[model samples]
Target: MKIKSVNLETVCGITSKMPENDKLEVAFAGRSNVGKSTLINGLMNRKSLARTSSQPGKTQTVNFYNINDLLYFVDLPGYGYAKVSQQTVEKWGKMINRYLDGSKVLRLIFLLVDIRHKPNQNDLQMYEWCTHYGFNPIIIATKADKIKRSQKAKQIKQIKETLQVVEGTPVIPYSSMTKEGREEIWEYIDMVYEG
Candidate 1:
């Protein structure tokens, strides 16, 4: 999974249609401020290709990043932002649902959660939605560098329990700053692609 080239191929807004991509698609879903953009940038090995911002809920569209022209890293809009209006949130939700229902190449979803906190209601809902769509999402515990190494296992356990993930499901603790767990993630992606 060595990334030789990365392109922001498509940006699907609330009223826009998703591209009928010919390549495999893996999506990233999580709550606002959960470091979705950071993780995407880290995974892509780029600084600002995914557009990280100081404000939460800045990602308002489904960004399709073409990875080495082989697969797509689908960046779904972050959910559960309080500052956003209810209508806007609903629109975002509908847009995500449309993609989930409409995408034919979507293979896996990497659900992100903050390592420093328990999975919230929104997080649980997102996990449920992924499962409901018949996708067994791989949990990525972001901000792992913010916690102590000793606390990593405990936090991962908490996330699994809170999300009620199926047994043996991987909950990887990842750090965008240190790039911890990046290789594991790419390995899993390769496994998914191969399997």
Candidate 2:
């Protein structure tokens, strides 16, 4: 799908604040600093479209971006930030859960993971949650450029093992810095939109 136009429509703190339109929505969810924003910007072929940040847990709200007036790219707040209090994390969890369970138009979920590290407990939990809720999750392993080409397979295997992803589900290795896996990611998006 060609991205003719992309614009931030709204920053929603709760599900009620989400855009009123019933466009197809694909959400991005992952741990803090997993390069969710960067991947979005890369996929749109625009710089700073999703507001990349150096600090983890900077995105504190569910941001909806209107794409070509046909679909919505929901940028969810990252989880597993240690600096924040337990209460704040619990509150964010509630908000995210509400949006995930309540959104009728949410078709696909892209779960981002830092390729340099193994999938943590938070990542596994999120994957399980998606499965339990009946959402199709496409695992995106970001920062692939940081690793050597020969080691890519090993890393992918480790990630799959750690995350316990089942067969047939895609686990794409991506690099926002190099724009790697951009086409593959878009292809996944196209398949979702077409389906």
Candidate 3:
């Protein structure tokens, strides 16, 4: 899908209400420091529109980016930051739940994880939560270039086994720096919108 126009249409904080959107919505979920913003920036073909930061837990709101006036790329707040307090984390969790339970236009979720390591407890919980809410999330393993060529398969296998993902879920190895796997992700989005 060619992005002709991009607009940051909506931003929902922890206490704010999610907008009642009519277009198809796809969300990106992952832990802090997982390159969620970087992936979004790469996907949108823009630099820093999603606000990549040097610090973890930078994104604290549900940001909705209107794409070509057809779909919304919903950037959910990143979770699992150790330096953050438990109460703040819980609030973010509630914000995510509110979005999942209330978004009528939500069609898919792209769950991002670091490709160099195993899935953590928060990652597992997030995966289960997405499935429980009827979304078979597409796993996007970020930082693919950080690992060696031979290690990729083993790391991917570890992620799958650790998460216990559902059968046939796509686990895409993505590199924001190299823009690898970006086309496949866009193709999947096109498929969802076309069908």
Best by lDDT: 3
Could you give the C-alpha RMSD of every candidate to the true structure, in order shown? Answer: 1.2, 1.5, 1.0
The residue-level lDDT of candidate 2 at 99 comes to 82
lDDT, each prediction: 0.89, 0.84, 0.91
- Tens-digit per-residue lDDT, 92-194, candidate 3: 8899999999999999999999999899999998999899899999999999989998998899899999999998888999998788899999988997789
Report the error of model 2 at residue 11, Å: 1.1
Instruction: Write down the worst ten-residue block by lDDT for model 3.
Output: 51-60
Candidate 2 weakest lDDT stretch, 10 residues: 13-22
lDDT by residue for model 2 (1-195), tens: 778999899888744465665788889999888888889888887888787767777557888998998888998889898898877787777777778777888888999998889988878888887887887689999999999999988988898899888787788999977878889888877876788
Q: Order the candidate numbers by TM-score, best to worst.
A: 3, 1, 2
Ranking by lDDT: 3, 1, 2
Q: Against the hidden true structure, what lDDT does model 1 obtain?
A: 0.89
How well does each candidate superpose onto the true structure, as a TM-score? 0.95, 0.93, 0.97
Stretches > 4 Å off in candidate 3: none
- For TM-score, the strongest prediction is 3
